[model samples]
Target: MIQLDQVTVRFRIPHERIPTFQEYAIRWLQRRGVRYSNFNALNNLSFSVDQGETVGVIGPNGAGKSTLLKVIAQVIRPTQGRVRLRGRVAPLLELGAGFDYEMTGRENVFLNGAVLGFSRRDMARRLDRIVDFSGIGDFIDAPVRTYSSGMVARLGFAVATDVQPEVLIIDEVLAVGDAHFQQKSAARIRKFRQSGSTILVVSHNPASIKALCNRVLWLERGVIRLVGPVEQVMQQYAPDAPSPFSK
Candidate 1:
C-alpha cells in the first residue's frame, strides 16, 4: 500500500527549477500589488493507493495531478507531509530522467537499476530481458542520445520495471509507442496487478484509466475535489461536465 499525509509541494517560479526569469519579476513589480512570486504545485494533497488496486489521478490543467504522481513516485520529495510505501516503487515518469545520456543504453540499464535500488547481480540477470523488451537493437551499445525518443522510453521503462515493484507509478509517457507496444505495456501493468502490486496512473487519456483502474481521484486547483469510482470521476472531469475553469 502507498499512503500520503497532507502533502504539499511548492516550486519557486524564478528559481533554479526553470532558470531565473527577470521579466517575470518585472511583470510582478506593481504599485500596491501583492502576488505569489512562487507557485504551489500541490497543497495539502493526501490520498492512498491500496495494494492490488489501480488508482487514477484526473484533473484539468495545472490541477496538481502530475505533482501528486511525482510525490508518490519519490521522483521529487514533498515540501511538506510524508509518503510511505510498502515496497520499492517503480516510477515511470519521464522518458530519460532515470537514464544517462553519456552512457550506452546497455550500461544505463545497470545504472538505472541501481538507482531504483536493485543490486548489480539482479540487474545483470535482468539485462538480457530488459534489452529484448526495449527492442532497441544495436543502438543499446551506443550513447542514449543516439537512440530515438521511443527507444529511450522503452529501455527506461524496461529497466524501471526490472523487478516487480510493490507500487507502480506511471504517467502518460506510454503514449509514445506503437499500438502493439502499447498493448504490451498495458499487459505488463495488468500482470503487476495480478501479482498484487499497487498501481497509480496519471493520464490525460481517461479511457485507459476506465479500462484499468478500480478507483479514481480528481484534483482542482491543487486540492482533491473527489475520490471514488473511475466512471464517476471520469464523468466529473469530462470536458462537457462543466469546465473546472468556468465561473
Candidate 2:
C-alpha cells in the first residue's frame, strides 16, 4: 500500500553564523562568506509496506524516524526519489497539527477533519463520536490554546482513528496521553489493524513496537540498519539484554 524508492531528504543547514536577514543578504551578495553543510535526514532509504502489514520503526534520536513518517505522509517532499501511496492515509504524526489555537476545540475538530480531506457532512456525522472519545467533555467548547498537551493528544487520536484509513501513520505522540488513555488508544488501533489497515508506527518504546508490529524496520543515521521480523531485528538493535525492548 506504500512504497518509497531511493528516498533521500536533504536539508542545507547554515554552517556559519548568519542570524539576521540583513546579514544573510550581505553574505549572499558576497558569495564567499556564506557556507552551508548538507544534512541528510534520509539517505537513499527504500522500503515498502504491504496492504495489511504492521511495521514498527525503531531508532535512536536523530535517526530520521520522524522524517521517514513525514515523507510517507507527504508532509514534506523528498529531495530525491519517489513515494507512492495507494490509499487514504491518516497521519497522527503531530498532535494538534492542523488545529488553530484561537479556535474552539469544537471548531478545530472540523478544521482538522477538513485538513484530512473529510467533507463537512462526514465530520458532522463523526463529530459527536470524536468529542465523546476525546473525553474533553465541557472543555470541547473552549479555545484549543487553553487545552493541556494531554487533552490535545486525546482529541487528535480520537479524530484520526475515527475513520478507517487504508494506511495509518502514527508517530510517538500516543505516549503523551495518560496510561488509561494510552490503553484505550492501543485498543482502538488494534481494531484498525483487525480491519486490515496498513500501519507504520515510530516508537522508542520497544514493548510498544514489539506488541503492535509484526515486522520491524531499524533505522540509524538516516539509513536502514535492519529490516526483518520484530524478534530478530530488535535482538540486533538492542543486544543481549533481558528487556531488549526497553527504551
Candidate 3:
C-alpha cells in the first residue's frame, strides 16, 4: 500500500543559463548573482493505492508523471507534505539507473541487488535466472557501456522483477525493447499482480495502460486532473478520439 498527503515537489531553476564554469566564475567575480525561479513539479498532490491495486498514471510531457513515481519510490523527497509506504518496493524508474557503465552486466546485477538490500549470496542464487531472463547471453561479461539501450533496460528489468516485492513501480522503461520482450515483461508484471503485489505504472501507450490498469490517474501541469476507473478517465481525458484499445 502507498499513501501520499499533500505532496509538493519544488525545483529551483536559474533564469539565465551559465553555459560553462568559466562564465559562472566570471559572473561570481563580478558579484552578480544568478536569479532563480521556483517551479513545482508536484502541487499538493494526495492519493492512495491499496494493496494488490494496479494503478496507471498518464499525462502529457512535463506534467509531473515521472516526478510522482520518483516521489513514491523515495528517490525524491517532497518539499512539503508526507508519504507512507508499506512493504518492500522494487522501483524500475530510469533505464540503467543503478548501474555502473564500467561494470559488466553480470557484476551490475549484484551491485543493484545489493542496493535493493539483497546479500551477495542471495544475488548469486538468483544470478542465473536474472541473466537468462535478460537474454544477455555471453555479453553479460561485457562492460555495460558496450551494451545497447535495449540490453541495458532488459538487464535492469530482469534484476528488479526477479524477486517478488510487495510493491512494483515502473516508468517508461517498458517501451525500450522489442515486441517479444515487451510481452515477457508484461507477463511478469501480471504474475506479480496475481501474487497480490501493488503496482504503479506510467506509460504513454494507451493499449498498455488499458490492459494493465484497473484505475488511471490523470495528471496535468503538476496537479491531479482526475483519478478513477480506467475507461472513465480515458474517456474524460480524450472524449472525441476513438479508443486506442478498441480492435
Candidate 4:
C-alpha cells in the first residue's frame, strides 16, 4: 500500500544569464539581483494505491507523471506533506540508474540486488533467472558500458522484477528495448498483477496502460487532472488517444 498526502516537490532553477556556479554564488552572497525561479514538479498531490491495485499514470511531457512515480519510489522527497509506504518497492524508474558503467553486467546485477536489500545468497539464487529473462547472452559478462540502451533496459527490468516485491514502480523505461523484449516484460507485469502485487506504472503507451491498469491518474502541469477508471480517465485525457506506434 502507498499513500501521499498534500505532497509537493519544488526545484529552484537559476537564470540562464547566471551560467557559472561561481557567478550564481557571488550574486547570492551579495544578496542583490539574484535571479531564480521555483518550479513545482508535483503540486500538493494526494493519492493512495491500495494493496493489489494496479494504477497507471498518464500525462503529456512536463506533466509531473514521472515526478509522481519518483516521489512514490522515494527517489524524490517531497518538499511538503507526507508519504507512507507499507511494502518493499522495486523501482524501475530509470534504466541503469543504480548501475556502475565500469562494472560488468554480472557485477551490476549483484550490486543492484544489494541495493534492493537482497543478501548475497539471495542474489546468487536469482542471478541465473535474471540473466535468462534479460536475454543479454554473452554480454552479461561484459562491462555495462559496452551495452546498448536496449540491453541496459532489458537487464534493469529483469533484475527489478526478479524478486516478488510488494510494490512495483515502473517508469517509461519499459518503452525502450526491442519489441520482443517489451512483450516479454509486459507479460511479466501481467503476471505480477495476477499475483496481487501493487503496481504503479507511468507510460506514454495508451494501450499498455489500458491493458495493465484498472485505474488511471491523469496529471497536467503538476496537478491532478483526473483519476478514475482507466477508460474514463484516458478518454478525458486524450479523447482520440494516439495509437501505440505514436508513443
Instruction: Assess every candidate by TM-score.
Output: 0.82, 0.91, 0.88, 0.89
lDDT tens digits, residue span 169-231, model 3: 988666657788988988888999998999999988777788899999999989999999999
Report the Cα lDDT for candidate 1: 0.81
TM-score of 2: 0.91
Native-to-model Cα distance after best TM-score fit, residue 227 in candidate 4, in Å: 0.9
Which is better, 1 or 3, measured by lDDT? 3
Residue-wise lDDT of candidate 2 within 9-127, one digit each (tens)? 99889887755888877877888566789999999999999999999999899999999999999989999999999889999887777899899999999998898888999999999
Residue 86 Cα positional deviation in candidate 4, in Å, after optimal superposition: 1.0
Off by over 4 Å in 4: 16-25, 28-30, 244-247
- From the highest lDDT down, the ranking of the candidates is 3, 2, 4, 1
Q: Over the stretch 165-237, how does candidate 1's per-residue lDDT look in tens digits? A: 9888888865756777778777888899899999888887766778888998888889989999988778767
lDDT of each: 0.81, 0.90, 0.90, 0.87
Model 4 residue 188 CA deviation (Å) reads: 1.2
- Of the candidates shown, which would achieve the greatest TM-score relative to the real structure? 2
lDDT of 2 at 170: 86
Residue 204 lDDT (model 4): 86
- Stretch of 10 with least lDDT, candidate 4: 15-24
lDDT of model 4 at position 111 = 90
Evaluate model 1: give its TM-score.
Answer: 0.82
Off by over 4 Å in 1: 13-38, 239-247
